[model samples]
Target: MTQRFMRATGRLRIIFGPAHSSSLDHEMTEENQRLLKQRQAEAQQWETIRRPDGSTYVVPKNPEDKSLR
Candidate 1:
């Protein structure tokens, strides 16, 4: 399966002279990467199964996880 990860380049602003815009952009990029990693980790713990009704459901591979819907 293809992995879905965000390619966030962060927000850029018009740097006229001296400003902390680059730092702010870097923060945003870091946040995006963190979230992307979190999602990938969650996906790894789940497995996709198709029901008899032709609907797909994501269930955790770890049977101990009682978060099944």
Candidate 2:
């Protein structure tokens, strides 16, 4: 077919597909893993305490209350 003849009959086409996401959670480095573990250890030290007045308080299980600062 001639180029001009083909161009006169050609129609546009559109294709769609599912959306995708790329995640970096699986790409942790050794230093990132170590820091995550350390932070988890520190978070484990938090405690929820109840008082005689029925008030609630959150404090570190350790003597130092870092959250207060």
Candidate 3:
């Protein structure tokens, strides 16, 4: 029997399944690990500010509200 699994990104869907081997499982694991690393690297490239309360926010390159400045 084959099973299907879907990864969701908001309204977007990524489907990969029906895999039937240990090799397939290993491949999927590697792919997920690679994607996670890529996302971590991308996040590190962005600017973020940490609050004293332990919350964090991404610093916008442009401010939409002029009064904020």
Best model number under TM-score: 1
Best by lDDT: 2
Residue-wise C-alpha lDDT for candidate 3, range 1-69, written one tens digit per residue:
222332233233324433343444444568888998888765555578899999999865445534323
* Segments of candidate 2 deviating more than 4 angstroms: 1-22, 50-56, 64-69
Clashes (backbone N, CA, C under 3 Å), per candidate, total 0, 0, 0
| Residue-level lDDT tens digits of model 1 in 1-69 | 111111222222233332233233345568888998888877788999999999999878997876422
In candidate 3, which residue pairs clash?
Answer: none
**Cα lDDT of model 2 by residue, 1-69, tens digit:** 345554554442123432343454578889999999888877788888999999998887877656533
Q: What is the lDDT of candidate 1?
A: 0.61
- Return whichever of 2 and 3 wins on lDDT: 2
User: What is the C-alpha local distance difference test score of candidate 2?
Assistant: 0.67
| Worst 10-residue lDDT window, candidate 2 | 12-21
Q: Point out the worst 10-residue segment of candidate 3 by lDDT.
A: 1-10
Give TM per candidate.
Answer: 0.45, 0.41, 0.33
Colliding pairs, model 2: none
Task: Arrange candidates by TM-score, descending.
Answer: 1, 2, 3
| Ranked candidates, highest lDDT first | 2, 1, 3
